[model samples]
Target chain A: MTEDKKSVCKPTVFEELYKKHSKDVFNFMFYKTGSKANAEDLLQEAFVKLWKNCEKVAYEKAKSFLFTVSSNLFLNEKKHEKVVHKYIENQNKSSYKDNDTPENVLRQKEFQDKLNNAIASLSEKQREVFLMSRIDKKKYAEIAETLGISVKAVEKRMHNALVILRDKIGKI
Target chain B: MKTEDNIENKDIFLAKWIAGEISDSELKKLVSEEDFNVFQEIKNQSEHLSVPNFDTDKNFSAIKQKLETPKKKSKVIPLWMYAAAASVVIMISFFLFKTSSTVIQTSFGEQRIVMLADSSEVILNAKSKLTYQPELWKFERKLKLEGEGYFKVKKGSTFTVETENGSVTVLGTQFDVNTSDDFFKVVCYEGKVSVKQQNKEVILTQSDAYQNIQNEITTWNSKNEAPTWINGEISFEKTPLKIVFESLEKQFDISIENKTSSNKLFTGTLSNTNLELALQTLTSAMQLKYTISGKNITITE
Candidate 1:
């Protein structure tokens, strides 16, 4: 058990992989899900999946697996949230509450709300792709690989998310 | 990039537009020269969406902490998922917990589903508050509610979902209890849930009903009821203007600035639409001019 694990068991390899990719993985998830809590959950789940399948998993392919699992799980959670309207209180120092505008930030409060709704309203997968692209700032190649779809599909969802947002918020 | 490329390239046009990198030819492709002016109006609204105030480290940590409990399979859901949520490896370095003594509170439209140490799950509604003595309740799982929550209590010998106005005692059942402004409603989705309102106890059995909303219980008595938000389904039931705004806020995690809200109530059944289309329905229905300003939805007369 001891001597052969180093021969085939690659925890050392996995540790190195975690060090290299966990940040990007977590960031991608955080941006996609729009909740730190959901992001963290996805991040851990991705790694756990990788660990369980470590025998067939390669370091290079790990990134793809993590992102794929993350995207799917986040989408699943969004789809079946179970609890309705579960708010986290005392949880944030909300970056900007001041709604400065032509009206001097009067609508600032409403702005964040609209953004949240806009994102939430998006098809969970589309929202994920958009957040990962813009907020996590992921590249098309990385996203395409992780999503197990063509770059064209990723771009399409990203495009649809934007269109829906523009149309929804644009009229308001 | 072919004959019917418009269907495919339509998304590309949007992507390029969002990046502010659209070409002249593509710009023309989006809208004809005549409608270009009007299309831009909608496009202007479309570009207003963006992620905000995201601190990756802090957020990841908060998620990690909530999910840090030991892996226990007390229900149908597999425990593998929770383990994936709070692994120490993925645990971010920074997290901010609530400083307030209030154990349960929601901001704006945020909802929380909490599984107590005993494995009962509760869904807290928007702008609600729940305060319970966390300690000194080892023998019996005790908590107080001041807002709306749907509880799925794990089978415990003495289990109760209590509130300021009333309390619901349970022998392991599922129910939704909404207690606010001295009005209380308890709807049992599963099992037997009894309501106690000051020396009066009424048991709510499942038959598709709503309890104590604005001082009346609306019972459809159909087994299939609408728990829209839980499934990310937007069900707008010809509600009032203010309440509609409130629903929008809850659904989007955003708000609207109403200098003065209208008294007119709306009645319609709206089931799934993309977020924008849904909001657009409001603007069109109200005939109000709305300017989408980067996460902010500003409406003017």
Candidate 2:
């Protein structure tokens, strides 16, 4: 049944793969670099590369293939210059409707910034796995499958990331 | 919290807690009450934290455009570059034959204002070359422009600026003429100016703009009384990214290797003084990204 499926080279099939995987892949890159602009650049490069090599990449393997390609691209970029990891926060103020006092809002914003810095301070490996699990809500097994790592490794990274973040953020 | 359990077991337990596999009472049993609250808050806010929203459709179109843009001919010069070089060479050789002509050229990031013998003023933009014969100027006001120049011609019989693409003639008025390979633009600020390109002739009055991009003629009303470049700002109105990159290259004296085939149009203004701010302005607006290594820059989407 898998062999009878359409080739990934077909525009329709390739586009389907893009729509399905591009967002996650972009988030994956964003989590790694902590910069949306860099992530967008790397995302475009990975998809274009996938299109160029569609003959070899099957539809089922496209997501992992993109992840691997983008990861490698990010690494190569890192070798040339120190990648600045500034996570620009877009204010999602409406989500916290519990108390709308001015002081409470300022305190929340301060806490958010500190939390962002703590996350950015984590090791690249720990940060990616942790964000993939917490932010993207991916399972350990799914994250393992995409990163080509074992589930045990994913769990270890996630746990370490939490411990480090908790220590850095301290109280609240 | 058991002493007999190893680190791996704790890893699995925390992972399960994060995945919501463990009940809150059970999680509290593993950690202090304060720890439980912090852990719960971390989990909740981390989920709430959002990165920039990635537009799938827009990026897919950008990717499709990149894939379609021809990449095999990396060694060959692009058509616009070829046209620009040829036009400059032709303009230079035409001047080389004139022994009594005066030529004024501005290097990269340099602009110059020259007062003609006829008391007319000409402001040359960066990387521009202007040539005129003083002897012939008394009989007929004619000059050649290799790049971009704004002319304030003295009221006379006919003042002409010859370019590779076409010629602009004015009788004592202010106007700007810009020419490159397959691109010609004439903006009139005051008085009447007649633009001739191939077989097409257009007359532009005050606040009139005429542009021919690959034989496609478009005319629009001007907004400003003078070119903004004189004020140290480069402005574009629905201009292609290619032209924007070229202008940046000329202004910053840098070579930009554009790696994408994105035909996105941009309408904005950029400062000529600061390269970093200019690149940020252009890339962020175009929804693209760039990396600068040494003097070379690469733009991608």
Candidate 3:
């Protein structure tokens, strides 16, 4: 297993993997925890862990490893925080809204709030697949690899997530 | 349009659209559908979701720096490798120091004073050369000399001067040794010196001189404290005319051509400071005529 990993995990190969997947992993973490600081911290921790185990982890499995490590970390953090504490904490921080007219700003803020609440309402599996597909701009094949599911399963979960988000957020 | 089949088909289309795999016609067809606006709105908003600003260059540089620093548990060089490297350095330094032995030479008509590693002094005559190993001087006072030199040895261990013809060994004394082609001479000034030629050994004390001419060994007494040539005078005692002319050539930086036989012996002194007067003195004493052209002197009888 070590020799198999060493054949694939060269430094240049690892760097290419980091470039290909880091932003997606960061977005996956950010949407999962809904906190930029926590997402950044988890992103660094995931890659550092990848480097530490670089010789043991195969290059092709790097994406799955990053997503799995990041999601587990997010789940562990979620188990420690009370729902009320999470709500209050999210309420204190405003999601990024572009500068516009007063009415536009209010409308964008309302839509962002509804979007966040809609996302928060999703099942863990559905949300993970949806975000990996949508926000990370990953293909169904990549989403399936990361979530350890079939491509058809990834599509089904992503479709369910979109339907649920559309219902919660209402019309545009 | 609101049928279950239509809903399933729309979900597949929406997934394709979000994955950016939808063809242009497929996208146009989807946009014209009734529920397309909702899915498009979700897709647009999701794409615009803000992520944390990650400075990848900065983070990668930090990682690179961490990897470059030698870790405490990194593989240590093997002991034999360190020993090999040390031996290589030792060999290089040994060769560098050994080849730094002192070598002194004087051109024709040029004289110099040399101070050895042990503070001993030597007055080297014209066309002389001397060499000694400075690192081994204290343990063994040995030197190699060519041509002639006057040595004022400091009282120490046995001082040995080697020449092409023979070797001279002394304890602590002043002496002069002249080693030229087929001729070797040693004159002791203040102390004793031992001369070895082939199987023969000769020792000389103060004012004692030993000369080897054409395989013949001769001894004589000197009235002066040093060789006369050192004081701007060239003196010879039963020396061949050929040797006398060779000395003149060395002392005056001239080339002498003897067209006639020069087997006769010469025993006289000539002033070394004046070329013309020295030539006159030598020629008149030998009843030989000579002519000088530039630096060349021709002798004829």
Candidate 4:
């Protein structure tokens, strides 16, 4: 379906697939590396790959195929020996942590505190796939395709990841 | 809810609950139980996760500017080291070009802005594609776009953008093309654009759209409105039924068909109505019916 993805004139089918998958792949990588800068770079890199081989990608399977490529690229990038520039530490907390209220402020602050630490403690794969699927709103099927796993496996993994996170995150 | 029997049904219940397919009574029962606590915990955790949608306008613009700058002169090396240095240069250039070109791609519902050979820019909307052929760009300033793209061609002697539908030849022009679906439309924004659709040729100035309607060629003048949903709003005045559905299809990324072919002639002027309202208005006006599930929007007589 995307055979002419490399064609100069028309918009290829793979582009639509990339638009659908970029957020999922980037968020997955971001949650894994715990760095926004790295996630952005990785996302851009993953898209470049999709454009090159767009001809092989069918419209029906583009979503899954993109994820698979993203996950692979992210994993390879993570297996680096040399360290480059350090990530810019998030000195200023995101406004997301600040709730507007004098009464619930204390509780919201406490909730934020727990979330910060709990999120840091999840295993690599668990955190990466979980956040990609949950936080980025990617479907389980997309996550599974990116990780080269079955949908059932993705479901099980997501549920397990959620369970671990639920036990540790928030004020439940 | 914590009973062994209830525990056995939890997964099925959870799936149904997420989809909102559970009966009201069943939902009420579940809400009143301890399992609801677990569900609440999951929701709380979910709420804490934040998505930071960063804008890369600066990065994109800076890269584009660099691409547009005229070529700089390279320093010459000694002739004795020419063979070795040339081979080294070739290898390095090849590696850099390959890595950059192969690293990014787009899918349906995705658009990317790319810096072309001439330094003029193109914004690809969803379901559109742009590819960079760096090494071969010097010979012919050419780039490929699939799906659809809005091109702001920079002023240059020779610059052209290609698509499966046709080729737009121009030195500099601002134009938008819808190339993803079966139909291909070109709307010139600023300068003139000559659009070549295979054997059939069409040229469009600014604010004009070259569209093929039901196998008969037709051109839409400035009076005929262009699609503008990408800016998060749509304005239609006295637009036909088929065109309205086409624009809506791009916005919702779903198909809306008039299968019965009963009221092929539909006229409406819509602005800022919700998608459902728009659908309802069109369906009611034409006395047509539709069934929607997932991404599928099927229409009937």
Best by TM-score: 2
Native interface contact recovery, all models: 0.21, 0.55, 0.29, 0.09
Better of 2 and 4 by TM-score: 2
Native-referenced Cα lDDT, model 4: 0.53
Against the true structure, candidate 1 has what lDDT? Answer: 0.55
Residue range B1-301, candidate 2, lDDT tens digits: 4554534477666777888776777777878887787777777678777778898888887786565432542121222221111001111111222333566666788877666776777777888877777656679888888777877777888988888888888888888887677667788888888888887789898888887766777788878777777667887766678778877887789999989999877888999888989999999998889999988999998
Candidate order, lDDT descending: 2, 3, 1, 4
Indicate whether candidate 1 or candidate 2 has the larger TM-score.
2
B-chain TM-score, every candidate?
0.52, 0.67, 0.66, 0.53
RMSD per model, one decimal: 22.0, 18.7, 26.4, 18.8
Provide the DockQ value for model 1: 0.11
Best by lDDT: 2
Worst 10 residues of 2 chain B by lDDT: B84-93
lDDT of 1 by residue, B1-301 (tens): 2447667577666655545556546666666664444345434432343433445456444433333332342222322232212100000001113321226555555666566667666655555555544433457676666555556677867667666566777777666665444345556666666666658767666633334434453443424342443434433333356656655665466668865456565654332335577667777777766776666777766
Please write out the lDDT profile of model 4 over residues A78-127, one tens digit for every residue.
Answer: 73223231222223344334555765655555655555565566666666
Better of 1 and 4 by DockQ: 1
Q: For candidate 2, state the interface root-mean-square deviation in angstroms to 1 decimal.
A: 2.0
Model 3: TM-score, first chain: 0.69
TM-score of chain A of each: 0.69, 0.88, 0.69, 0.65
Please give, for residues B169-262, the per-residue lDDT of candidate 4 as tens digits.
7657667665433445566666677777757666677676665433445566543233343333444433356666766665567777657756
The DockQ leader among the candidates is 2
In order, the Cα lDDT scores of the candidates are 0.55, 0.76, 0.69, 0.53
Instruction: Assign candidate 3 its CAPRI class.
Output: incorrect
Off by over 4 Å in 3: A1-172, B1-100
